[model samples]
Target: MTELARAAAADPAAATSPEPVPTTPDGVPRGQPVLDRLVALLDLERIEENIFRGVSPAESPVRVFGGQVAGQALVAAGRTVPEDRHVHSLHAYFIRPGDPRVPIVYEVDRIRDGRSFTTRRVVAIQHGKAIFSLSASFQLREHGLDHADAMPEVPDPESLPSFADRVSEYGARLGDMAKLPRPIDLRYVTEPAFLSRESGPRDARHQVWMRADGSLPDNDLLHVCVLAYASDMTLLDAVLVRHGVYWGLDRVIGASLDHAMWFHRPFRADEWVLYDCASPSASGGRGLATGRFFDRDGTLIATVVQEGLLRIAS
Candidate 1:
């Protein structure tokens, strides 16, 4: 038997008959079609007791986006866990570029289960090769000492131009990209990386307001997964903006190497959260970025750190 099948066979909890699952979670809001696709993306299919399958959007880019895999892997891990337990942290590595044309299979291994904490490791595979892996820890509700960094002052998200409005100046230059589905609403507190490239080099820090485009079902894991999907949307930009470089505009090709996140305090992904991102250092063709999510009331919600491989041409 396969190692995963043996593991499932060995566990009484997993040996029981499996239940039916839907491609997308129930009560998926439909008013926002793009967001609907995103919601459907996270709802993985239960391939077996310990394996799940996910698909990329039909309009996926050349390669699968890192965030999509991370979020889907987390959803796979979360599915093997209890609803009462909430994921507190996750660490992931991108081993290889994912192929958007095929299905990605997620294999979940129950690492540990304690009274207070549960952990699972997920491997995303395609063509019988591991493309990505993630380990996540879940914790039951508990009271403990608490402290966090104060949030930075930023203009209201409503005051800032919507992503489309802000990028309208690029017009024909952005072309098809401008018409793409945006499941997450973005509001930059300052000039976005590309716009700043035009303005000239400046600081290493920038902030943006982020949230799901529409209402989400009342599920903690789904919310966290959505935020995970959104995290990669502009994290690499933090690195590029530091040197005033852009993707197509500059001779630069970069990919996310690893991603880590720690969730703190309960928050809704549908509600606006200020994402403060900055790159601390760049060397050896790699750049590292750190980000913190804060709610409208300035309460810290989550923290993220990512490193990417950036090959820049002189």
Candidate 2:
């Protein structure tokens, strides 16, 4: 097994079955909770040749995160490609809010299998209607001219405290922001939490260090899903910072409208990756942000772009 797989195996928390369930007093599975359990609810079953169906438990709101769906769809598609090939890019659209109470069916269509690259399209359906779609490309790694931009200098993840630690330190002062489900550990290299008073004029740039709470599978597909999950965390917020609006502040409302990513190289998600983000424009109550992910060795693994609905309270 690869190091990632070994690490994942070592983590006691990573072995939970992908079935949504409520946690007991010790965070072990008990029954099921409406929102919290959704993260665990993807049932994979074969439907057709080169196609699979994923079902989720019935709940009012969809229990799956958009990134999770994208990542899972990528995994389904990756299964059809050669193990040597790695994901290079993915573009997906969310057509409707997924219904948690209903199960989603993902149909993967093999578009082409070329010598150097393979392509696939995934359509996520619910209630017999298409609610999400993704197109992904995979490529085999080959030796060639290689170069990458310098990694951004940032404090190590160890030097900074986890977001949860900060929240506990702040207590009720965190307000509704504390309610956000923080599955990954995040430490801002530029702006510390709850230090808005020290924040000055908005800048387009942001840098942070991140890694999964535990190790993940060695499979490139799983790493890509982890990247997809982390990609959505702060790209939109970078735009808000450009406008001098802290998301935690009561004066602003923000939501991701669309997200896209391009994987440039293979990298382990279990390791620390430098995320450098910037916002180029914000107008008409909308904002656009772009980001790049670099491994510790300065390999540019991925590039991301996102547009979000940003409305400042009047």
Estimate TM-scores for all models.
0.89, 0.79
Candidate 2 lDDT (Cα, 0 to 1): 0.68
lDDT of 2 at 162: 59
Could you tell me which residue pairs clash in candidate 2?
22-32, 58-101, 59-100, 59-101
Candidate 1 steric clashes: 0
182-281: candidate 2 lDDT, tens digit per residue:
4455778767424532475467777778776554544567778778878877777677666566665547766666778998787887688988999889
What is the C-alpha lDDT profile of model 1 across 1-314, one tens digit per residue?
Answer: 43233433454342332233211222212224566578778878888999999999887778998999999999999989888999999999999999999999999999999999999999999999999999999999999899999999889999898787776676456555555567788999977987888877778887899998766666678789999999998887888887888877778889999999999989999899999999999999999999999998999999999999999877
RMSD of 1: 8.1
RMSD of each: 8.1, 5.4
What candidate 2 gets wrong by more than 4 Å, as runs, is 1-43, 55-64, 169-181, 192-201, 246-248, 251-253
Top lDDT hit: 1
Q: Estimate the TM-score for candidate 1.
A: 0.89
- Candidate 1 worst ten-residue window by lDDT: 21-30
